[model samples]
Target: MSPEPYLGDTTRTPIRHHILSVLVENKPGVLARIAGLFARRGFNIYSLAVAPAESHARFSRVTIVVDAESAPLEQIVGQLDKLVNVVAITDLAPRDALERELLIASVPVDDDNRLTVLDTITHGGASIVDVGATSVTVMLAGTPDACDELERSLEKFSDVELHRTGRVALPRLG
Candidate 1:
């Protein structure tokens, strides 16, 4: 028999993003087990972030951005629910959630473009984090779309090194 098609095959299903906020006991190997499940099942995880959820360090919140085309949302959630450490899972729909990502970029600059680069960065609502002899580094914490636009704008500068933290989200209250 032919191998099963990749769950997120573009031709089979249109791509969509689903953000899942998972709460789990803060224990070793829990993250590894979750990642192993995705690897074994061929699910596509677009982005993931994990951090302590409480000061007591008893639980962690894992934010996962999944490729909706990879598998049925219900199926994915059901599989995650079977994990022993997973305490709860909440799907944060775009409209019902608030999401943010952090972007840091270092762009080469010179006498001719330093002012212009600063202008662009400030105008984009990013703050200058560092200034070196030949480059300037900027930081922006914003919605994914805003970060995308800023990244595109920086492409005009050659040798720009950009890093972005994957999205972290929470459901909106009220």
Candidate 2:
């Protein structure tokens, strides 16, 4: 086994809460390069979200979370921009960003149920994405602060599982 490489000085205290926004051409291995960059730099990413940015062409918007000093983060983005497919890369975590979060909870079903399915729909912006005899998938998207409140409401039901995606944010363009 081999130890991972460090992107910056291996001795510095950790710097928390850094976000990277990437615009890359949607291709077969584009994602690999982006992920590789972080790994090569010895950066530990906290959250990653990638989705299609353009419908016409194969383009994607990737958001990655890391803890690094200013110079390292800047260099990471700078190097990425130098690539042929990298359209743009910005560290949006410390910038003027708009953030959102999503939580999907699954609840089990039983013979005697006090709170019916409809009861769950009306609370906490919960929307039924799927429903079966055994479980139900309810999705809620909003600020992280409110996610806790929603979670509490779901506790009353037969919640069996929870899935959380990392917080996502983009600069608030004026």
Candidate 3:
């Protein structure tokens, strides 16, 4: 289904999370302007990811996940559209998009439980990216649910550090 346009009345819609994919000029200050707009309007951003778009040097795509309950989605999109550097904006429906996040975690591994730790990583479909004397860094790139499962499994071990990329998504092709 196509997304409702920002010009329409959207306040009647139930409050929930929304993901906005915005394409903007790849120049300094664009990110700040978009972020400032949200901040000035008191919109709470859940997660944001930005990168150059499809190898293009002049454009970048920003994926922003926000709680629509904080503010009307139309208002937020309208304000974003008004920005000078913003080229386009698309609201990505969760069901119609492919979303993924990258997780990196450091788990302590020793002679006693080294095999167990590797087993956990293997079962979770993650890869051991680095190996240290006492710790191994594992990397997992998968859906949020998969990442959560991996995190829970890793908790069984001694966790030294963990980090995850917020999220990035694209609409699925027919």
Candidate 4:
């Protein structure tokens, strides 16, 4: 099966990142099947995030970011649609979507640099979630760029541990 071309300027050769919002059955192994398809097709996934969808346990949402130049977008979408558990797929345009990622960082903060660390976090619009005598854990939910900026600033601190959730997005509605 072949998917219809939904992306404009299919002839363009520049590498562009695309976000695919997939709705699938929440049953086991659904994620693996989708991921397997990408692997078999030699498509590289830049980031992927999966979570429950709506208020029901019967569906899950998988948000995947891929480089369009790495594989034919139509072919990828077609293969994904063939999966038995897949319900829907939406290709979100970066400018027309609301996207966010969550980042958590644990930084060593002694008396000397505690204020500096806190100030950096505050400047990044992040909040301290946990504070210990020697370290502080902060959480930030924002765009990928914002998270990257925060990560770079936090790197100056000692013993910093950081983790980020992949991008997740929903199309904007009028």
Candidate 5:
């Protein structure tokens, strides 16, 4: 018998291509249970973000990115909906959606590289959100690959940090 395919990508290409949005009641243990389920199921959640909702709803919007084919992804989606606290499950990547982005990076800079660093920021649609004598943290919002591009462009200057909010789309009408 052959071993099962690994998570994320079977070969080099990521198999599960999905961005799942889960609405859940904000309370202790709820998040853990949900996460535990994924862990046990061997889902490679590449990215996830959770925060409370507005209107005192005490709900959290969890964006999950996973790699698998359609049929497998459907099973995962169905199982996710069965969880007790899950309120809604939306495939935001297929549909359109809105997302919030937060970034925190610590970058080292010296006189020799400061200009280069500044140039990278300008090109990345980001600015220095925080500054210190030897380091700076640049912040930006957009696609994950955009942020990766910025990091790649600046790789020569010094060490860098990157965080991606992943790709999110909302219906054009909205």
Candidate 6:
């Protein structure tokens, strides 16, 4: 379904985030064009993930989480629609979409905090992927909120490195 045109509606409050599942031709420079379009229009993207769609490599799906507060949702979609490579754009409201994110962190551990770190990791539903003499690497694949919580819990470590794969989502089927 297309989004309602947001023409300066002061009475209505805008949603903070809007996920756009964009289908595009699998070709070089398509991403560049899309990024350039957002840059030109000054729309802020919160998270973006792209991958080949279905069994064929002829098309790719781009899941873009846009900051709705940054620009009018209608204009963002309109600019994206103007691109020739873009096949289709589906705006998925947070409730209508199922989203997931992956976060990997390598946190330092000493005798003092090793047990506490492991406890935090297990409590957060994260798996210990790798263990070392000085650190442990944990992987968490879950909802965005869960990942954020796990990250926050790990911040007590002095040396922790985190890498997150920005959100990827699909429309929920009734």
Candidate 4 global lDDT? 0.82
Candidate 5 residue lDDT tens string, 1-174: 212111121122233456787889998898887889888887767677776755656788777776655347877888889898999887855324343344446779888878877877777666677898889987766445445556577667646766666544333355
Cα-based TM-score, every candidate: 0.87, 0.68, 0.85, 0.88, 0.78, 0.89
Q: Count the backbone clashes (under 3 Å) in each candidate.
A: 0, 2, 0, 0, 7, 0
Candidate 5's displacement at residue 58, Å, is 2.8
Q: Compose the digit string of candidate 3's lDDT tens values, residues 47-95.
A: 8999999989999999998888899989999999999899999997666
lDDT of 2 by residue, 1-174 (tens): 112111222112124557778888988899888778667776667778888886846778888766665347767767677768888777765445665667788878666662665575445656778888777777777655455556776777755587778667777779
Question: For model 4, what is the alpha-carbon lDDT of residue 7?
Answer: 26
- Would you list the clashing residue pairs of candidate 6? none
lDDT of each: 0.81, 0.67, 0.82, 0.82, 0.65, 0.85
The segments of candidate 6 whose C-alpha lies over 4 angstroms from its true place after superposition are: 1-14
TM-score of predicted structure 5: 0.78
* The best candidate in terms of lDDT: 6
| Model 6 lDDT per residue over 75-139, tens place | 99999999999999999887777777788999999999989999999878788899999999988
Which lDDT tens digits does candidate 1 get at residues 1-174?
Answer: 212211122122123788899998999999998998888878889989999996859999999988878888888899999999999999976666677778899999999988889878866678888889999888887777767778988988899999998889877788
Give model 4 RMSD, 1 decimal: 8.4
As for lDDT, the candidate ahead, 1 or 2, is 1
TM-score, cand. 4: 0.88
Candidate 2's C-alpha runs over 4 A off are: 1-15, 69-71, 111-124, 148-159
What lDDT score goes with residue 10 in model 4?
Answer: 17
User: Between candidates 1 and 2, which one is better according to TM-score?
Assistant: 1
